[model samples]
Target: MTNSTPLLEINDLSLSFTSYAQGLRQISTQVLKNLSLKLHAGEVFTIVGSSGSGKSLLAETILDILPKNAHVTGSIKLDGAPATCAALRKMRGRELLYVPQGVTNLDPLMKVGHQVCLRPEQKQYQEAAFKRLELSDAVTKLYPFELSGGMARRTLVSTALLGTPRIVIADEPTPGMTLDQARETLQLFRDMADKGAGVIVITHDLTLALEISDTIGVFYDGTIIEQAQKSQFTGLGEQLKQPFTRALWCALPQNEFSTPKHTGAAGHATSSASTASQPESKRAEANSQVIAGNEPENAHDAAATQASEHTGGAGDATSSASPASQPESAPAKDAAQHAAQHASVLEAKNVSFCYPGSKHCVLENINLEVHEGEIVGLFGGSGHGKSTLARVLAGQLPIKQGSITFDGQALNPHSCSPVQLIFQHPELALNPRWRMKRTLQEAWDVPQSLLDKAGIRDEWKERYPFELSGGELQRFCVVRALAPTTKILLCDEISTMLDAITQAHIWHLLLDHAKEHSMGMLVISHSEALLNRICTRVISIDALNNHANCIEDQ
Candidate 1:
């Protein structure tokens, strides 16, 4: 790669970390192992890998942000000039920029305008970049604390553009926005590259990456194992003509595949035969009833009487009470006019919360209820404690004050159960150390038989997270979360990181599961479109803040 020819090139890069105990031995975690990549001017490079596969580490290394405790050995060349650690660090704020995974990069205390232009090196270019980034003028006066999740993302994009850097590195930039917003953001990145800047996106989202990237790089085991033009990888039938290729291909979509169709019939047949031979196979299932004959009423009465006597007659009725004295099963003969309503399933009362040391409340005076089988949405601005509130509802976090009751049972913060939280980013939620089966195994309540029935064929339980794509990781997360003792499902912005099609599939799966079991849910989200699709009722935090607004909207 020549100077002024290629924007950046990394050769034989390796990085790792060391850990030592007080008096015992030490340990090392090998991260990136001999990874290499190149970014040309006016091109978009996408890196796709599962969680804990060193994708983030590789991006951090390129940005010169790797931890000091880590050992890094690599040659990073920028525009053909040797990029030393000191040189990269010295020019970081001016010649290079990064847009991080979520909304945390922006300063909450400062107005978005001030935060966007906070870069000392890029201060002079802030005004022009703000306009170029398509940020609203009102954004300048509003702090990050007040912006919606989508708006916060726009601020970060504006901030990165302000630097006018030669290369822009974005890590999971579209994780919390609607489909339209995600597409538009990707278009912006494409436009940036069209103007000669190098753009590198680090994500597990293959569908999103395929849409905008010029070049695609697949990461496996801390290395860039494959690279090709985006066009070459998009056509599944064309891209994968071999068995191994097809396995990787199917894995990308969160589906399981063993090999390619073009492989010898014997190869395919052997795999199919193995699958057929497995015990508990339902593909050949018959709808035959397996039951014990019903017992007679007299027999049941006799058993009940004996059990009542042995248990000290808790089930015994008083001799003086006649059958007519018992309260009617229905309050009235024709009860429709005065039917008693069931109690609310769950409620949040007068809840107010703020992060530790923060003066502003993210959520305030919040009162809400979830009925037995309805799906509710907690829609709000970024950092407004949407995740925090979901955490509280799922008992992951304790409410600072207020109460939550489930089915008339007071919810004890320390003893909450039967509620599950499916995180938005699977990469963060999944354990890298566990194999696929072991991870799913922790859910326990999902019948092993049912799992086997729904199991994706291409999935290899032996493979680690590093070998999977974003969609694959997300599917595993879904399987793990839903395969449990589920009563209430608390979804924390799960769809924000997925592509439109994938999001639709996940939403449908959730709906189907809920319908099948009559489950209740409280879904936390920022995308109105997604809420409109899956939620029965959408409760905007802004509306709750003003009673008049709620009344007017209603």
Candidate 2:
């Protein structure tokens, strides 16, 4: 029973913001340029693209939530009639619903149950929504800050379920969820579309998009470059029209995992007709060689060789030096020997942690170690204390039992910590009032080289956190954590919000810098494929905690 006419339509929609330059001069930056799309009843349409490509902006525009300085020129139609901002506002809760990407969308002071239900009559619907999303009834009584990332995400989804709406817009809703949870969430949207609601999903995860979408729109440079049926994204993306679309498909972790060969004027992937026409086997072979050839022999050995070449075998030693501070002039053999004899850069010896009033211990007797120049992957299901362990290691949370140490010494809370954490939600971690430049430089004076590598532009420095997209803000967070004094990094799903190419680029730069400085990293993620590619060895949270059966199994 699909509708013949469109349920929602946008015609030649554009959006820009007015900002000030250096000397009281105003400039307009257009974020969405003539973007247009249609949503039909009983169809799930997905928009996939790199981060900062205006996907979220489209969602905001439809909801009539754009800021005061935003200039919008567009026509939004519902049921074949023009939909104004006032009309959108009036119909927002009853006829339109949204599942935002940021968990910060939840009001901080209000209880979760109150926010989800909103009215006394919605209590039953709220309970049902929470149960379907696997949230505990007790969660309703808690505040936003009291819940874990996955719990917070589920809470947001519950709000959308409390009403019957004609259109549902979900923006990047699956990052903090486990694979099964993410699949279930997407399936819920698919079911909604089956019930004659127009569903619009925005994400950078191609695998998930392919599974749930009826039509896929490739968004790039503030416009839809290509639109195709889900069936068209088959083996090698041969049927896809746009080169950037094919490039995005090939860049998945399970696929070629390679960047595009050519770029357009905006530095994005451009069409290479000749390359696209090549046989699939040849392309696969080339990609395999590229991946295999890039593996370093030994991270520390490479670091030692580079240091020796630069410093010419000079040795400098101090009494307080840690393992990562092995003399710059040390030869590869000596560097290896020193690493073998030294303690791990960060260690948790029989560590256990519990929340202030919770009866259950989230983490118990967790023995973990991250050595210098090692990338340790932590894999677990959602709400399994993976993030809690990262916070504990980074000293954001204190352990109730056992000991945590850095280079065989206790962490000093007074001074700046050598271990820094990069959170999954960059928006929550950053200051909304501060400009990007101030936020990036809050910890240290980051170098221009790092900014360039992270793709941070000078113009972006003038924007606040809300003005920039999630992926753009994440780049700043990554660069901020790479200060010279940092010895270890705790990355919790850091690349989940990025597109395939940007994800690969950031990882490449991060891996190189970690090897060069002999910095250890504890990478926490739910993607087994990603962990297999980047980690020295992946450890399960259940195994690390010595549990036979975990909460996820139940």
Candidate 3:
């Protein structure tokens, strides 16, 4: 447990996937770059990054679970001995455990009880673990589909601890759970670490995870850009060593977002004016009063009145930033004023939907409208139907109760779908077999400049989904959704998997394009700060559903 002998040590780990592109041409896509970390007993080591930053890949590599085509070059030592695949086999379940990000890990046809119990003798331990996680006896008899998302996550957590592993790697284990459920699930990991077990958790953000983590690793584009104590993420992120780490900390809903003055040599946010010309710079500095004064008398007219009355308090909170990061307050007001004159482009009137077998409806009698040149924020937590409503509006899901119209025409997924949708999980949205170039070409003949604007490299065009990182693949998806035919854009947590700098650039491109074409967008995200910064009006999905519970707490 001491520095002299750590429980797990990963040194200079680099991973690449060998694949055939186009014809029989061989290509290797390097994913991890010189990744190294040490996990000692009794510490909750948390890794936070944008999607596809190789956080999950690191966990998979440590567990020796990478696919056959994966070529890894690194030294992983378990208890100071070289950890090869054979060594991982000896340590996987007995000494080490893994909690996956998705709940589909459970076999659909298998009973929850059998899935948690690794062996016949482990049934008793599995039952005890379930009880500790607050799973009832009846849950054991049910299938995964019968369980809620929170319940399924708890089941996965219990499965990982069946053998009481000394080292645990939990990859993005808190998604789809309510705030309290996520906190409780992470607390269980913290408890495990407190009892002298080495625990690792990969997370999207540190808003809740920070409270339990002892140390934090900030990852950016396949590398650990910075490592710091949990307490170092304070004020304006001055204690943080890496610019990307500071940018991530600052971009949180709780922190003030200063425009990136420049990107550092490592691609981290610094004083980079490189992306300053992006439309996001203006949107990011837009009048906070646009959505901060609470829901207006009429959500559509809110931006108009607020822009008319917005004064000079926008820069006060972000005073700690450098002069270059600040934008003139006049441009934001002008942009909002111009947006106020646009006509309605999309509408969801008295719409409601529910999963086929669910007892309660996720959305009920929801009425909303998006005006031309407007960015409406659909703010809500998991289980509140933010995603479902997005799918329905985008015509991905059927409209059963009411209607969703774009440009006064019915939305049809099979057709041109003026309502283009960029999904929450880019991995599922993109085709695995298609190369990046082909994926982009499916919708529009996207230009290289457009791809570059989305932070994509030209070389990535030849690589398949498996060869690219999650964030990289997502960049392709974003560019595709911005097709010329798209009218009402449905951005379902589009930037969730991207780093702060890349996120800024993409938003800059989207907002800029939206302004030029007078396009309306429905932005669904859990980050209230982001919604506040970019949206003309932010409305709660739960409020739309007539649920009066805590929206942020889910």
Which scores higher on TM-score, 1 or 2? 2
Candidate 2, clashing residue pairs?
A: none
Candidate 2: tens digits of C-alpha lDDT, residues 214-308:
99998998989899988888888999999888878877766655556554322333221111122232212222333333333353444443322
Clashes of 2: 0
Q: What is the C-alpha RMSD of each candidate to the true structure, in Å?
A: 14.5, 8.0, 5.9
lDDT of 2 at 335: 60
Residue 3, model 1, lDDT: 46
lDDT of each: 0.59, 0.76, 0.70
What's model 1's overall lDDT?
Answer: 0.59
Which of the predicted structures, 2 or 3, would earn the higher lDDT when compared with the native? 2
Candidate 1 has its poorest 10 consecutive residues by lDDT at 282-291
Tens-digit lDDT track for model 3 on 87-138? 8898877889899865557899998888888589998888888777767777
TM-score to native of every candidate shown: 0.59, 0.85, 0.79
Q: Write the per-residue lDDT of candidate 1 for residues 1-554, one digit (tens) a residue.
A: 22446889899999887755457567666778898888998889988643445777787888777666788887889987898878888768677878876565677687766777765766666666556544556568776655555556667776666745778898877666545566777877888889878999876456667788988777655887777665665444367433333344553323321223332211121122111111221111110100012233344333322211111111112333212223334434224212213423667888766556555566667787765455666665443456666766776665667777777777655643666788765666778899777887776645554443222334345557654545556666776667445767788777555433334435555655664555677777755434533444456555554321121111
Q: Give me the runs in candidate 2 sitting further than 4 Å from their true place.
A: 1-3, 261-338, 546-554
Positional deviation of 511 in candidate 3, in angstroms? Answer: 2.5
